[model samples]
Target chain A: MSSGYVPGLEGIVASQTAISMVDGENGRLVYQGYVIADLAEQMSFEEVAFLLWEGRLPNRSELDALSLELANHRTLTQAANITLDALPTDTDPMDVLRSVVSVQGVEHRLGKPSVPLAIHATASFPTILARFHRRQSGLDPIQPRADLGHAANYLYMMNGKESSPEVVRALNTYLVLLADHGMNASTFTARVIASTESDLISSLVGAIGALKGPAHGGAPAAVIEQLELIGTADNAERWMRDARKRKVKFMGFGHRVYRVYDPRAKILKEMCRRMNPKFYELATKVEEVALQILHEEHPERPQSTNVEFYSAGVLQAIGLPKGYFTPTFASARVAGWSAHVLEQAAHNRIIRPQSEYIGPEPRKPIPLAERV
Target chain B: MAEFSPGLEGVVAAETAVSEVDGANGRLIYRGGYLIEDLVPVVSFEEAAYLLWHGELPNESQLDALREQMATARTLNKSARGTLMAMDAATEPMDVLRTVVSAQGASKSLTKPSLDEAIALTAVFPTIVGAARRRGQGKAIVEPRADLGHAANLLWMMHGEEPAPEKVHLVDTYLVLLADHGLNASTFAARVVASTGSDLTSCVVGAIAALKGPAHGGATLAARNMLDKIGSAEDAEKWLREAHARHERFSGFGHRVYRTYDPRAKILREMAKTAAPDLHRTAARTEEVALAILHEAHPERPNATNVDFWASVVLTGAGIPKELFTTVFATSRVSGWTAHVLESLADLRIIRPASRWVGPEPGKKPLQLTKR
Candidate 1:
């Protein structure tokens, strides 16, 4: 009645969510029926998060309330703080989030997924990253500022002073753009965990793990690294061709969805061009050559620039260390992940897929003493 | 395009030689094509773990090498230790396992998943689980014993006494049996994380989060709790009948795979008689009634007792606390999780499945925050 094998589950539909949709043929992303283009520059991460959770944009009062709620929960739990301190100063921020979030989310036992828990978990991510970033840099960790909005507060905590409005707005748009992305691997991981009727933290924790992979959220850092190695626009062709010979993948160049340019990447690329001209110049040339070479190799495939490519330049402009790239991605995506978790929890089915076992036929076992 | 299959049921998401659950025939074949039944008596858990990673049965020297490798990696890293201490001892051990594993695997930078990292990750689990168990009892955390093998050391750390050979054999067999199964949810979660080119710890942490779901690794704990609720062999029929009348799904009675009896369950069912004889008697009767009731309701359903049904008893016999059952499952399954990650590295592709949009049509504009 069903197909046997679908490698990479290419065309399989694993979920049905009203949270977001990837209109791959049209190169659009929609959050609750609003095109990302309309929402990205206009919304704060908190309002978009509310839209994702409640299926509508929050009114001024509702937005204010939601912002306050997020602000209130931004500080880490004492145990979580202790756990954060326990980690090595040099530990990856993603790993710190994974562990500290677990400690922060620990309950006496399992509880059903809920909205408050999601909000709490989302708020903690920036704090965890900022604290660890400070610890790594040997700077004193700044307390979260309640007066600041989500993006501003994260900056304040990281730099110990409020950032300019432009930087905060840039980050806000970045978060809004990256907030949700249809049924991605990390979001699917969240849904899979939630489908088991597990707690929200469990789902969030699982999604974070999925995002840690370079194939998923790990590429933004690599994009910066690749650019650093290439040095300048003049070197793009030679460096990229040499990398191809060595089988060094061009990071952030492919997407399974999106026939045209990624909508998010289009927005990020603009921000990158304005904010980081040096990175933008080299990245643009690399993108041109890569697409041309890729097209020559496989004319049928739609291998275009993804969000991670220009995301490197924008994040670098915003002054996050390269190491924090994926973790920062997680901070934005946690909204999507939590929303997905809640969505899955509402009409849950245990997402246990069947495996076609291609192994030996059963036989009796020999005692160990008699084995060869 | 394939139609949406809820749960991705019957979707063969992967191809592998790690292990196979030949559900129709009730067989489990581990890597190297060794049948579960055949391998159980012939190999120790350590040897089986070696096989999963190396694709061959380890000879004595290899087994010893693996044992030595595991022993050296058994102690928790400073971060992991601090994280465990930071948690409330009364918190769910799975939460602790997830958090501490994340901490233990935390690094300054992301490293690709590797066999050495796998062994280190696997070795650290018993230490965390053992510590969590001790802390739960208001007892001091016990250190792992180098002289003890994996299963034996787990017991020694938990109880501060040498485990009996029979108990060790039962635990080891349980571990070996669960070492891998083709593309189960948790393993799929791990592979999905790895697909992102994430590190081994992140992959394993994700798997652990997925496993926390009640429908997956938590089944053993749920199965045991059900047995405790039913109380005794004499109470089995009445308890199950009432629970069935109320339409409550029995915890360990049904599986997605295994058209017949589960091979692991069958072996554990027999082992239960000698392992936890009293609980085994109760479980055996409970299984009989549950299966009968299940068959009567859905004549064509496989309706078989799964490994968790018997695993609960065996784990109990092995002196594992119920809270630690899921953590114990992680200890066994981490080897499988890491192995799948390593194998997938050879053919890494982002597992971003399509989602059929069920939301409102796009192109809606948002109102200003004040206007809204």
Candidate 2:
């Protein structure tokens, strides 16, 4: 009965590949028809990306080509670097990403009559990430290396050094975890923009802006801070208790989608173990303490650990600074976001919903002087 | 020349009888006499929503009608379910809502009354959020309970089981706290959409896009990140100093609207006091340290703690995970968004803003020597 549609029937279907599937009854997740568990364990982030776009696993040659292409595009343009350098250092990373993506659109001259969506994303993603890292590190952007892998090249540009296998693996896992989720805010924004038949860069810019919201891609690093507050297990219960008293929300626990467990949590937990055994132990202890307290306090709510819980641990164990958690999330999520934009574009339609107006009814004009 | 509504700086304050913003004094009074805390203690979310919409307390029958209407609207269509199921499991839940709501416009019956349809349209919002989340977890969707109140049903649907009465009440209070604010960005966007006489879904979709911005509903997640970065109280000062030095905008501190203190912070702080006593102490200390540092650093910007600062504490204490903070915000805000949309429909007008065109007025050939 609201302005848009009958409550149950709106925006329910579209023609697109299922980027991810949520089986609410069983608490499971799958991406691009592949079980999340399988992808997290077996496939590289680049491979997962290919799967999302190509609709199947890539052969070795195809994957190698895609990797080379992605790596080649990792370098930012001179104009892009200039634009990023001109931005204020205090700018939120999301805003930075948005601005850079917009500029990329201009610099790449994406407005050219006909450009493929894949080419746009492929060219834009690396440039966006590289420029973002450059700005964050107070350095000028680097040129993309055609010889490196996507993960290796991104790390190279980000840190100005070749990444270790462990680091690349960690980054790859992070990317895989962040790659996609169903109809999230940023993806929706991308889809909305795409519905308008906006170019990929514009859609990506919108998506980046949407991702900046705290509710979306910004909670993983906060989980690490929560753990630090708990410190040793001795202080965990007390700290959690105190936190509960103040009503502070613990990072990385409950999720909107997963009532029982976040599948990504399991994957990240393993990744953390592989990265740093000590931090993994500490993280597990923190989780235990938080869970124990939650169970005792409000057992009825079904609060449990979600992706961010372990993601914080995994990223931290891998030696990434906490500030970069969100940016890293952006890097991985770019694939899924681009994919969703493409999907929306494939069946392009403007996304415009209605509203339920609840303000003072239109009134007769009141004299400005008489209106106290 | 296009007419501009100048000198209408604070006129909206008098027009919408929602909340009185004493920007200079740092106070927000909802309705005529009710302080935020006063309402927080006794008012249910449904009651608060009615007050915002009708500008008075709803009678029992009116309340019942609203409840029934919301209940009836809670069921999501199969198409929406499929769409949600198709999303990446790791994608942010709010993004999913934004996309679904935007796409929802296409499925509506435009011939129907916008308000009546909007009410029904928005009713299913909680279900969409709950269902999408559950589906991501691979859990079966729970059917909405006709007998339960709005908050109670939402919790039940989210968890796929019944919630304890106390938990229900807690969620209800949380929702009440989030129900509405003045014309914040997202609500303004909703109004913009409604002004065009578009459907409710479009308004809500636009509002969701706005809410996805970090400066808006995303603050809760950012606040959690700040807490995470600080780890323990001992680390707070150092972290704050570094962050400030780095020019990172602290999430939970400062506000665009409230010059002194966010009133919602007070209410949530009290609630945290009752629910999680231990977290309360840490949160209090955190607040103290943050306030001291903020006061010392930026004496000019009235760096009063806002709703997000305490809301994060309360929700964290209540054992809700950090990732859910923004989702919770969305849940509470949906009511306000719907109310604003309904308000916009009362006097239909297109919200088309004109820009000051500084370019040459009409097409003109360049003065070339050869041409001359």
Candidate 3:
């Protein structure tokens, strides 16, 4: 066993994955053989999901079949439906996703990770969130429409009406950009579960939990919150400087990887400008000031704006609530999570990493009666 | 970057005082540096849990307070119960455990992992496990008894009768033996999730998902089933020889860490002789034959019999059905999982490890959808 301790396993190469790569030095993201930029604006969310799961982009007929399968699996199981209603109306949507997804997958026996399971789980996330959103607002739930594309159906289910084509297009791009990113903490969580030969839902439930943390998929809401605190473009520098001096983190700025500007962030920055100009105006100013301040503090570090920086503006423009941000990230990343699970199951090993003990030497315990 | 280590076999991910698996010497030490053998004879499962979370065993009054706290938290909240009742009675018990626990802990706010929440989470496990067990048996769910201790209450709720003292002792010992092991896969999963600054429920949920894997906690059920297949002591040699010819891996005979007999398995082996003499007879014969065959194939390997091997016999004697084996494992492991999360809270870092990218070059442009 390697006796060296790697804090956070930062430089440890845990797995060899073909699904996605974060080319941090070059500022590129690759899914299968294709660059993320090529897929972002041109492909539908379903196409990107297919590519992640199968290692290649789907053709026209294959894309149709995949879309239909995702559409068909949108309805929740009886257990999942009841579980959804069981959680409090005000419960965090991420918690709802974690609980409902667990119940939804409980009916199946522990089966190997497969594409069908991935598709079914990917399809259900939108339905789970939409239903929970409706219940919280005392509105009747809208059934998922088979005719709509993945992003459109998600929007339709949430609001009982179809969104504009451009809005749907923006969402598709956001989903595509966020679909997968190498072995991220959450994706690593999914793969770790899959390496144990656990089923797809178990892997996904674990991933959801990991993503709900404020560090990973939990960043979009914080980005929005920071922007709200800044309030306007005119106040960007002063407010951010004051907030930093008060020891508040400039949310959505730093990332562990990405030495150069993130590819997804570059694309979302453009989308924000076009779709949410007001947010774009204020956010760009804050991003500039935050980056400059961060650079001054850590000049040697690769401190740059991350994907979550502009994702808040884009998700808000697409009409999602702030609290739904992390769960929405889960909805997108479930594609990556399940794909990683399948890849892991195909070549499985139990991921039982060692730990260094830092405790007292072995000692005897006093008997219960003898204890004071 | 360090070379890719599959399953992170030798990688040391964290430094902790919670517990240690000193595999080379076959010693298992819990918090406060007490060896497993010393603690088992002196404390109940609750006291061990208290020790793991608080770094010391509770005194008499503290133990009494813990019992009362556990007793009060035994009942499932409305949402969790509704979700539990919603599942088909025929569903797998581990799935029920993962789902109901998720629902039970669902809330509007995201809270940090805490010691109090850990106790509550640990207390609720028996209630869910018992409900799932009864539902699987096509019997009515039983409410928990406040007067009974943790292990006794588990048997009482599942069987709806007074548990024999001998049986309760076996179950309690099993729980204590398995409660904590340093950085095992499930505990690693919990810490990974907790590193994201996720809530205790999220961390525990991730741990349960990992434990459902056949290579982890599910091995107990597999071990028992393999014994059932052997049928009797007389059949052990023939079954072992044939299974070896077929290249079937012996389920409970090998472990990666323990070079000698597993310390917990050693204790359980002794208890199994008295707890289920008939099964122990068959298991003893089967272990002998299996070890002989394994050694013949790989002589360099250690003489290995993991904790699962004997846990099966002991759990069987305690009257738990085979299907609930993983859930029972989770019932004990939630303590260790939450403990790792809380320990991790003092030094939280997002555990996004580096990945070895094995993919196509990133510059490849996507062909248009119609052209493709």
Maximum-lDDT candidate? 3
Please give the DockQ score of every candidate, comma-separated: 0.65, 0.01, 0.83
Where does candidate 2 stray beyond 4 Å? A1-17, A107-116, A119-141, B1-372
| Candidate order, DockQ descending | 3, 1, 2
- What's the best-to-worst order under TM-score? 3, 1, 2
Off by over 4 Å in 3: none
Highest-scoring model, TM-score = 3
Model 3, B1-372: lDDT tens per residue?
678888989899999999999999999999999999999999999999999998888889888999999999999999999999999998888889989999999988889888889999999999999998888888999999999999999999899999999999999999999999988889999999999988999889999999999998889999999999999999999999999999998989887787888999989999999999999999999899999999999999896889999999999999888888888889998999988899989999889888887878767788777777
Ten contiguous residues minimizing lDDT sum, candidate 2 chain B: B5-14
| Model 1 chain B lDDT-worst window of ten | B55-64
Candidate 3 i-RMS (Å)?
1.1
Q: Distance from true position, residue A198, model 1, in Å?
A: 2.3
DockQ of 1: 0.65
Pairs that collide in candidate 3 are A2-B10
* Interface RMSD, every prediction, one decimal place: 1.8, 20.2, 1.1
Provide the DockQ value for model 2.
0.01
Q: Say what the RMSD of model 3 is.
A: 0.9
What would the per-residue lDDT of candidate 1 be over residues B276-352, giving only the tens digit for each residue? Answer: 98998999899889989998999987788888989999999887888888989889999898888898888788788
Retained true contacts (fraction), each candidate: 0.77, 0.00, 0.86
